[model samples]
Target: MTYLDKFPTATLLVIALTLGLAPFVPEPHIWEKIKMLLAGTLARPVDIFDLLFHGFPWILLALKLTRQATRPN
Candidate 1:
């Protein structure tokens, strides 16, 4: 197993905490940028970077989980 498979729990926890709870904090910048993106208003370079910074980990975790689920036992 590679590093990703070895740390599935950690990845899941990060996904849950970041995407689930982080947005509730005062002035959640990443969440705001995501909303702007969905509303077709995200254009600033820093906002784009913030989106990628917070989003890439979730995407990778999702991909890892999907791969693990699809793998034959």
Candidate 2:
């Protein structure tokens, strides 16, 4: 079967939680935070792309779980 055939709700929920929490979590490294700020200021498009790609894996995982949960006996 496909990825969706595998943890649907949990996968979706975890991803949702992480994404929601990301903004609130302060960067531990000063340099990393600076880089993130600069990237947001300069390469805005890249940041959007990064967000999309980052969610992909989670979506796939969710789909897999949905598939598995619905799998036939």
Candidate 3:
């Protein structure tokens, strides 16, 4: 079967976006308290690599979906 027949594109996009975004969701904000306890030590860099890694796929998928949605089937 072809790609469209194999999966609903919107469902795939939601799943992909959810999985891609899973890492960056702050952990219930409880970690803020922990950080305070530790005096904000062990600071993690704003992982630019991770940002790009997670970001590009979603942007591409969005663009693809937009193009497909707007175009006549």
- List the lowest-lDDT window of 10 residues for candidate 3: 28-37
Q: Please, what are the lDDT tens digits per residue for candidate 3 over residues 22-62?
A: 55456422334344436754344444444445555566567
Which segments of candidate 2 are over 4 A away from where they belong? 1-43
Q: Per-residue CA lDDT of candidate 2, range 1-73, in tens?
A: 5434444567666765665335544642323434676676535676556555555655666666666678787
* Steric clash count of candidate 2: 10
What TM-score does each of the candidates earn?
A: 0.70, 0.42, 0.45
Number of the top-ranking candidate, with lDDT as the measure: 1
Candidate 1 segments whose C-alpha is farther than 4 A from its true place: 15-24
Residue 33: error of model 1 in Å?
A: 1.8
lDDT of 1: 0.74
Q: What is the Cα-based lDDT of residue 61 in candidate 1?
A: 71
Q: What does the lDDT read for residue 45 in candidate 1?
A: 93
Ordered by TM-score, highest first, the candidates read 1, 3, 2
